[model samples]
Target: MKGSDPKPQSYEQLPLQFQLYDCSAGQSDCSQCRAVPEEYGCVWCSGTCVYNQSCTSVPADTCPPPQITQVSERCSVLSSSQMTCPTPAVTPEVKVKGVWFQLDNVRVHYETIKGKSFTYYPNPEFFPLNREAPDAPYRFKPGGVIAVEGQHLTRAISRQEVKARLGDRECEVKTLDNTHLYCEPPEIQPLSVDDRSELPCLKVFMGNLEVELGRVQYDSDSLSVVPLAAQISLAAGAAVIILSVLVVILMYRRKSKQALRDYKKVLLQLETLEINVGDQCRKEFTVASFPPF
Candidate 1:
């Protein structure tokens, strides 16, 4: 057994082989944790990464993210002297722990009611909304429900505080519980599996509580007509407007031409009346010269 070392190497200084397993610490979600090679001795357990041997509760050589109840807390009282918010007078998780993180747009400080949780809080100076957080793989299309599973999900449902978004579009939340949240994305432009374009990551928020759910992926089966339909409607509207304007201009031109004809007809009649009156006056005013002859 060794007690102390006069010099120790930093983690970066470790050998390439030793560095392989240490990379597991960077994984924040279950899928990523599980993706780490098992030979690394890393196992995803209870929403955290640990050596497979450390997770004695699960089956031997097994790692799984256990199903645990999730909740968000809002405490009305704060102790300025203690610089801490008192835990609500509610049922707390049995093995309670807390982690500070900035998940997407919202700053988060979640108490893990279960096991060891990593802290990912942002330093306000370097914080930009949803910039650095990794995303989980979530396949979805408009009108289809996407389920969000995590801690404190039930609390969100009961409080009617759950909201979700993909990119800038809102995802209408349908139902939620402790371990799962069901939401439907808004209609959008068509996307296909073969299309190598990028879309926004999934984000869930409730007031100050925020969580980055994952990233959306399109598949062959998924397609949206909203954008195409909108374009068609806009084109139709423009055509109708143009037709109406043309009709109005044609009617105005016709009325102007009719008025010009009417004016010319009245002037001609006046000229004829003047000519007849002058002739009658001349005959009346003529002397008896013609009679003398």
Candidate 2:
């Protein structure tokens, strides 16, 4: 009976058999003919087998699957004991697409894949933008100084770098000595739908300072450089204001001189008229007194 119980067979009792065949047509009793089929069939086998007639093929090697790592969406809030809202996990496949920052210190980081992106906002609502809480116990002004620490900061970052990276983001930079630098984006026309829908932008900050490297903007249309124009307009406006002020001062002085001259001439004419009246009165009194003789 061929194992009627159908129990699992041991290695020694297995039905598997290995045999070797002579590869040479003329050789009948060669050592190659006696090679084991199971041993020499594949390169992984332990024994030799026929070169062509018997199994003597090599198998390919395969590697294990790749591993995936998870990135945290929520960054730690400085000095706050409470943890901020949970953020979505960032996958290796995700790429930074667009970035925007609020007037407050809170930063919003965005990432995208296949034209879709995710936003992660940090806790601690920034000031100036949070006007609703006027009497709130924790009122922070927009220009207050603050210090930040991050993984990649070598030195303090300026407000210009932050604006460049975050695109119209507003923040206040403070030195250790409490020197404040207010950075606000210039007011410009609104972006079109195409500009808003363009590829995602990323703004990375190390502490309070912004990272200058790896910053990129992918606008479909040409970049509208406005700094030069803004500067020129500012300069022109200042010059006009200064000139206007000078002209006003000069006009006021001229008017004051003309009024003073008119006052002096009126005073002199009044004195001359009083003297003439006194002389006429004296001459008429003398004539009246002599008329009786």
Candidate with top lDDT is: 1
What TM-score does candidate 1 get on C-alpha atoms? 0.30
Q: After superposition, how far is residue 39 of candidate 2 from its true place, in Å?
A: 61
- How many residue pairs clash in model 1? 7
Best by TM-score: 1
List the lowest-lDDT window of 10 residues for candidate 1: 121-130
Which consecutive 10 residues in model 2 have the weakest lDDT in total?
121-130
Candidate 2 lDDT over 158-201, as tens digits, reads: 33333322243433333321132233222232222235433122
How much lDDT does each candidate structure score? 0.59, 0.42
Give the per-residue lDDT of model 1 (tens digit) for 123-175. Answer: 11111232344443455555567766556455423536657777667777888
Please identify model 1 stretches exceeding 4 Å from their true place. 1-136, 156-159, 189-197, 224-293
